[model samples]
Target: MVIPDLGRSPRPAPPHVGPRPEPGSFRDPANRVFHAGDDVLRALDRTAAADWRALAASSFFPPLLTAGKVCGTEELPAGSPLRELPTAPASSGWATVLRHERVPFVSHPYEWSFAMLRDAALLHLEILRAALPAGFTTKDGSAYNLQWRGTEPVFIDIGSFTPLRDGEPWAGYRQFCQTLLYPLMLGAHLGLAFQPWLRAQVDGIEPEQMGPLFRGTRRLLPGVLTHVHLHGSVQRRSAATSTADVRAQLRDAGYTRELAVATVRGLEKLVRRLDHQPAATHWVDYQHTCGYSGDDRASKERFVLAALSAAGRRRLVLDLGANDGRYARLAARHADYVVAVEQDPAVVDRLYRSLRGEGERHVLPLVMDLADPSPGGGWRGIERASFAARADADTVLALALVHHLAIGRNVPLPEVVACLAGLTAPGGRLVVEFVHPDDPMAARLLANKPDGIFPDYRRDAFETLLAEHGTVEDRLELPSGTRTLYRVALP
Candidate 1:
């Protein structure tokens, strides 16, 4: 009933069925994104509205739009660009759509693996390249705007691509550094995982902040020099200047569409072959050096597969601290969507490479340290969502993760259970591993720290705490006498 009348006689009114923002609500003020009659309309402010209409009319946006590779959009109100721009929907708003085949899961930077982040950077650069000839530039370059449409990256917010004037430095330069450049540099040169840092600084790492973190070589890299060191230094040095001059200077930098596209391509090349040197840590052995016997490995695998089956069909599975996605693959079978999160850059790199080769779009790998998750704290705290805000997951696989939290990190089992419960969707499942004190992994983890403080950390205590949130789904002893697996479901 919501079909367009382009091919037929125009109707007097368009039926408005979808939810619309309440009048007077100032949500998304930057671009007036609201609902008008069953359609999502982005209201252009009067000042830039006419230019935007011209840019939209050009050959640039329509190719991707008609291909359905991008979101549906159309111009309206003839000659009045500020009025409204509407888009057709296969369904309704993003909040309530279930099993929505077109748009799948929403992912955040903290959840990206090295490759995913790198690819996203490449995609952004590619967009910049394509937009240059048409005199358009990406005003909003937040990583959130890039979403995976299958294996390839697609820009979601159509409003961000606006007509570029003669000489405006890419408006999103700082954001590009924070989200893409700094993180990529850390991962590539310093061998540091960007997830932990990204988690804390929601907006992104300031050049001033990132400058101090870099060792000598990080400061020397050419890409680092032009993009991070020099760029950030200039911004800080010029902080005293009035806002109008800075904007004008940036806009008058003689940065053409070609230069913008070239800059993006340059970034892509730099990120593709970045090499990160690994650091020494106890848990770093989770993949290669862990002294797990054959039996211990067998037990963990069996338990993991069982838990996966328990998740059943059409699951959005979350593998917390998913080192190299070894256990993530177990749940992949039952899941239509899988998000594998880990703290180590090395492990995340390996996992991403493997998944990328397989062309598996459903599994989204992220680099994250569970203890310090990404918090929402930028421009009014609404720029990015916190770890909990992003969690509407149907199931969580926290294998071999509790030991780090309880024994090594000093987190209580009850609080851990509480955190896990908070992430699961209504009636969602949680499959976690309990490592006994005698377990080799647990013993090694505790070896570095003074440990009798966690005397209450036992299987029974974990079970009791987990019971407070959900019923126990299954439990199996791992090959190691000290390790076992437990799956729980919310009552």
Candidate 2:
């Protein structure tokens, strides 16, 4: 189960290497990552060799590891970060160990909301604050490096740390501006979603582009004028020159550590000052307005709680199409962590807002279209992970979700059941809803499609599909109508 975590490089490895370790570990020389069963094996190369040893010895990494914010560094064979790491003869060099976590889940900046992006920004700044005292600085400041462990943002790329050079400008300052600063400011001031802009500008928002985007808001804030407005104008004027003496001008204009820190603090304050007004959209309004009697809602909650009780609360839960996180919060009450997946952009944004409050550390909201989810893209299209690859949950909830896929999207019943089953971790529970064709919601979905594409869209057929994957531990029909809840689990 070895997996390569390269961001977006398309180059194939040449066969000039000594003994190939694992396929996943061969992506970079800086850190040769392997797996010895469930443990992560890191082979430090020249870039990470010295720092790896020193960082491991330091007190900083340990607290983060204990907090589940970063992976723990274990004692491998006494070796230099410059040397090649050992691997089993059967290893393939990229990833060759039978580890529990094959790779990190793919999270794009465009999918994140303002609060999520802000938290990631703060996490990176905190990392900078922590690592700076340890004589290291981050070489990269992309939002992609931040991942959510529940509601908390964690920095996973330890290899991004490099030896700090004094008297030089912050290497990642420009990246910080593009990745975090501009996006936050745009969302706060212009009420932009930031995802579309972020997706189009994968590297980061170019200063030239920022000029036009913020054309209407030139007088909003002093910091925006200093950083984005004026900076963008200067970049536009200097477009033809490659060897422009911009750094000296910036230095003369007082871009010192104190100024940089103050500017960042201002950005932080601005991110917090954002008032995320819930934009009006179909799913955002419809999820609350449509289809469910008071009794039905209560019955669904009872069914979910019962399932959660039977499943145990020590593990993680994945709620597919978790619109606005109504049920996800319920799952969060019982489980250690809950990942709420919703395709509707508006609903996900709203849910992200609810999960951002302080002390809420059990929910993670993701934007994904279940029918055509995010595919592995980037150089050679091998850097990112697909939806199915990231579905490892202790339990899965598919409440009111199947009908949309089964009839609206025309997915087969067996495939729908199998997809829900795929999200379950070992000994995990699957709580799903099966709405008969006669059900109001199911009828509405059927109306969208041609006559009789889903002939097997019956409750019995759904149960049969469940039987093939796991035993149906419990079943209940809501007092409202033909909608039913089933608790299925692998034996």
Candidate 3:
């Protein structure tokens, strides 16, 4: 495989078995992403090929990619596999195809903490500001166009860029307002958490929806007054307005080139000042109560490091139930990137903020429930990916997490092992903690349940299930005697 500017990534690209259309790339008719072997190729439509030419000549792409502001992209070779697809258009019509460097892991906006969302909002505006001088603008401002690279947010969708035109209201103005600004305002000013709302609606809070949430005096805030309340009022009253008429009005309403810059600057200022003090949650300080003595913690850390080393030190690591990211940080020391996912948003928000404040570019904190994980359900039933489908980590860590799923959640032992196995890539390592039923934590979890539910809950039985998929590389019994760590190698 060819290495690129992003440095070495432990997660290998998918093998180019043949040209397969990417499910989520269908909405943008201007371009479609295809997977040929391990490479992600974006085939431009006849209309978009010319747009690509314009973007390439803008002098904006090179610096952005070099500085890691945008996703790294390369022009596809003349004989690239785009021609192999049965639906390939006439080769003479289109002139370019773009290949994007695949992100190690794709976490959705719903999974991001407040800080992560805030950073994405700022980055979106940054791109808008930078591209203005180049005479280009993003046609769509969906949060999905941005992805996490370490702790920094980077724009990924090149197809979203389009040439700016005079006297036209920004096509994506409403989109930026709804997807980025509104959510931050809701969380920062209204003190409402964004996770639940963002989780339920991937498109983010709308002006009509968020505007109504602001009560009396809060609605008077400058940002809320203009972007939310006024915009929503206008949107509601435009039901009977003809699309052409509305366009005509916007065209004549002095939406000059400078107006676009002014709009972006206003949004940037508003987003930059947004803030909220996350309230403390039960799991926020749970890591401190861990009775894992110095020896236990030290032993656990050693075991995890060894497991990563065994796996060729994979760049991507997924930690399920990463409360405060204790093991997540340890994993990050050896891996290129570690995704610390916890069900509690408050804890995740704090951990995310900490990582950002320290400029640690190796960990991404996200919210995810082990019991009811995210599913794939969007446009054409594939715009969003299920957690299991996208979690292709080279090594999966589940320290102090299995008991929550097995006893607390009442999930079967074999099912739990299978789920963990599915999360790890084939031949990848699985580092997990097995809490015996006799342990205080496990006993408390099963206190309300009947004993007959978990017949194979013992460590011996757990190892048996793990053996079905991978060999046990190493297993350690902590000094506390309540927990055991296993580094299993999947076949």
Candidate 4:
């Protein structure tokens, strides 16, 4: 397959964007989040406001920020620091606003690799363990509460932190299993890709979902009996019980604070021990099948380095179709951070694991099909920003990518150029490679198409289309003139 790492717009600030109540905010009465340009502002009502004020003054919150376990938070009084916020609800019930350190990139669980999900689970467990000692526990433990800052998984929901009551069962335990544990197991143990299910079932793969996947002998795997099979059975039995009655029964059955700790510990151990031997995929070994000779590959690498140097002091970089992230890692050296998007789940997991420790300090790989970018969803369309709206980069590396997009996805070349150009900040650079008609990969991509459909997809036409969207700074040819790389700046 010809590889183009598949990888949007701006309008008015909200109130124009509607009530702009972020999706899922209605579930919690404490606060609501609003996206105002680059800042993530959370408007807190009286209950959440009081909680924030107390948490801000305490010693507990400081350590997590210092340790990078949580996002940096600043209290913004309505009229003081935040002179104006367009998305705030008009009601005077709100007490204050919080300006959270924007996570460099916001990704969904469906977009994550197995390693990313595993790390997120551990992060959640760590927060629970840490908070319990501080006289609090996260009341809501959805995987969405976390976002990636390079390779680091940092907790983003300031509202999830609520006081813990003694002898209360972990409210998020079932959610943790459904979202984190079951999905991790599905991938690590069953060799299945959990992303599709995650995308379809945003609430996550439930015990019942796993129950069908595991039958008879396969049900004997570690934690499968208690967390999936039997748990699903118990959940089915408890369907008729009221929440208050269940609580009372749990209290009577000795489900205390100690059990809560034990539960978190058990989940943590299972999460840490979970491992996946990733199966080989067509594109995971990108360099081998990417149709590049050693010297030609090195030529593209040098071209990318030159582009980054020209772009200079890039705060953000993007690697589209970053199969195993060879170029994303190279871009990471030049930018403060990088988001690498790939379509193959196995490929994403490979790169995600490679980014551990020092490698993780700069690169975050996500599973996103280039043809279909993530869209805004939830309460209003604005709750989640489309990938196009949020993934702006100072420099973008679209190496070996456009041919597949134009040929594989049937997107017009000019439209493809414009789509990529829009992702770049004005004055930002795109180092995009064009695989010519004669290149083997390009021919393979074109084989399925009817003739004359993409007649304008040639190098000269590519330069013209690029000129329509941005200024072509330089063009570097590799593959002995069959494939060429264009460095362009958006108009």
Candidate 5:
């Protein structure tokens, strides 16, 4: 059956209006980000404007922009209407506007896998290394400044680049250690997940918090002794020292631009050397272990392909519980961009490494728990957007995921369907799989549960819930008859 266009139409782009300041951008007084309609803009003060002019004229910037290592940026014409918006700095009373190429998605470091975060850290350090040689350095070392274009990491904060002073120490040193360096160390050395720690404190793990965790021999690790232990000690000892006093002391001690260059070089070496291999999880090999006969697997693939093709090309496709990324890659064939969301970090890391090696630029893998996804946080919960806030997918692939949410997570089947429906954009499609209660996978999940629980876990109930959310355009029962796939079109 053909998938009909439902009553709801495609979502339109943002309307053109006066520039609205981004909530998280208030911290940077010299430069602030604004959104006017579909354009992403930045307003800079007098000092920041001078820095921007120098950076635009720099020999390094053009090459980086061409290489896709940095976001594409251009200063708007002086008479542009966007410049007249009330986005000027309070003290400067004037603004220089620049438009930035928007990223496909904005994901937090906490939602990234070990490899993704490591790559971001490396990118940050690499940019710093390049900038220092050209007498420029980033004013801050914030992981938030980095965004992804598919698998590629791009530095988005052009305002951070500032001219290097004569004898000034690297101003963002402490921030780098806390945000990027420590997180990498946490994963590589301790084999611990850094997401929870970063989510708990948006500023990242403090030196003091990290230093105490490394005991005895662990303290001798590459960057521990100097960057963590000594760094924390110094911070504590100089808690009352003013910023001016510290810079004066560093200058008095013969700190020079050359020293700053050395610091960046040392950091690059350390970051490159640090490697993390997550312990293998069950989901990592799910594609091979999943109990689907060759013919059944083929049938499932054909069904998914036909459904996606019938729906026509998609702007964005979200694959929930994308284990091994087999289906996400398939969805990519019909999508402009695909976000493969999986809860297991190890599985996502493996998928990311494979995609990166293949140079697959359309599929982006992220670590996210469907049950408890990333939430809005910082400055009254609007600074960092939640996954739900950003996920407006044209097509949502929920293959082999409903049982996990219903039986494993204990979310009611209706609620599970509702959540999936909510993620689907208007006039979007939901390709979902429902496993029978007697299915082996569903049986295993139910084995530990008390008797008579989840009594409503039936195929009929699932289809009824699906109908409540949208029109079930098509359905297919696999050869095994234990699993069924449904294609629903939302209004």
Candidate 6:
């Protein structure tokens, strides 16, 4: 199949079109991304254009793009109207423009669960393996290059693919270890969460930082000996050596393409075998243990469905603190896309696996703490957007979440209401549940806090704050009289 090309337009180019340059896309000089309204366009220099030509012609490209492993791409013929955008790199004139299929939402590795990151790593390796036989390979291994289409991972940076060179080691090997392999190993072997580390260091965990974590017998784990222990030792020894010198040495030592292929194969096998079975957390089995009777549970579900129906069809839905994605699955029936944000990694992992197994493609599960969500990070803190910046859901389901933030996290009721209001799109609806202070669950949350510290944690206070924030469209108290649900519409 040939790549689709939009021929040059007969009409004149738009005057002073201002396409916003992606702040995170500046690292690569050969190709850069720009957003012109709804279109996601990539500007390719002469060299990158050549690479794109090779990629478009490759036999593997069509199949991967068809299978959704790679982003759907089409070339804009030379002199196309989009080429004249103001944000196009003027220093080096672009030879061609390519448009990519936009993902529903952009999420970072730090916000992903263990399974999500592992799957992304496997997809990266799969792409490398597929490209090797066709004389092409990825130039970089960054977790950022991968984005999710619900439960599926798609490689977005088509510019990373290039014709392979003879006797050159895998350029992305160290990067693969740093970003993908080490993070997975940290979770699988140590049962430690890698999200915070990744959030702290966008470049990912280095071998030096990871090696010392494994002590004594732990160093003998499947990939630890070579990838972590010895790799760190080598990096420490070569700290002063120039990268050019290392490449020259490897070339002189006869490191062949076959070696790179073998490395890719080995990494794939190792990654596939790695698994993290986290110890049971409080929220992992919340659906079964949430203390809701049959009637109460059914009533809650009916209320949520009614709220969703009242809102009509939604472009996007947010399920904050989605315990096991029960309501996220429900919201999916009424929305184009649903983002299920849960703080517990294990719970999110289970949700992701179940969605992947069932071939569900509408609900995207994410591991994020509502108390401390993802922030603006990377170069100048604008390269990667904050969670609040990315979230603008038309329908937000904040079920069984307010108590956690207020009583558990100590966030005031007004602040919680304001935060939820900020997440709702203009003229959108928020379905939030407020657990009464006398409820068993709320009592458990308040058990450790000093007595009378949260006297204002009353239903009246919450409703007053909600009224101040938006119009209360509907309200329902559960049969148990322990929880109240409100469907508020933002002005």
All-Cα superposition RMSD per candidate:
7.6, 7.1, 2.8, 5.6, 4.7, 3.8
Better TM-score candidate (3, 6): 6
Give the alpha-carbon lDDT of every model: 0.68, 0.68, 0.80, 0.79, 0.87, 0.87
**Counted clashes in each candidate structure:** 7, 14, 6, 5, 0, 0
Query: What is the C-alpha lDDT profile of model 4 across 266-296, one tens digit per residue?
Result: 9899888888867887887767887788779
Off by over 4 Å in 3: 1-4, 9-17, 77-93, 239-244, 447-456
Q: What local lDDT does model 1 show for residue 107?
A: 61
Error of 5 at 17 (Å): 4.9
lDDT of 2 by residue, 360-415 (tens): 66678887778876665444444444567657777899988898888888788788
Better of 1 and 3 by lDDT: 3
- Residue 245, candidate 6: C-alpha displacement in angstroms: 4.1
Q: Write the per-residue lDDT of candidate 5 for residues 1-491, one digit (tens) a residue.
A: 01112122334666655678877788878888988775778888988999999998999877888788888888898988878657453474655888888777778988888889889988988888888889899988988989887789999999999998767677778878877889999999999988888887778889879977997999999899989999999999989998888888988899887888788888889988888999998998888876888988999999999988997888889999999899999988898788999999999999999999988878889999999999998888989888998999999999999999999999999999999999999999999999999998898999989988999999999999999999999999999989999999999
Candidate 5 stretches with Cα past 4 Å from truth are 1-11, 88-92
TM-score of 6: 0.94
Clashing pairs in 1: 16-37, 111-366, 112-366, 167-251, 199-374, 296-479, 436-482
Residue 320 lDDT, candidate 2, scale 0-100: 88
Score residue 481 of candidate 4 by CA lDDT: 70
Residue pairs in clash, model 6 = none
TM-scores, all models, native as reference: 0.76, 0.76, 0.91, 0.88, 0.95, 0.94
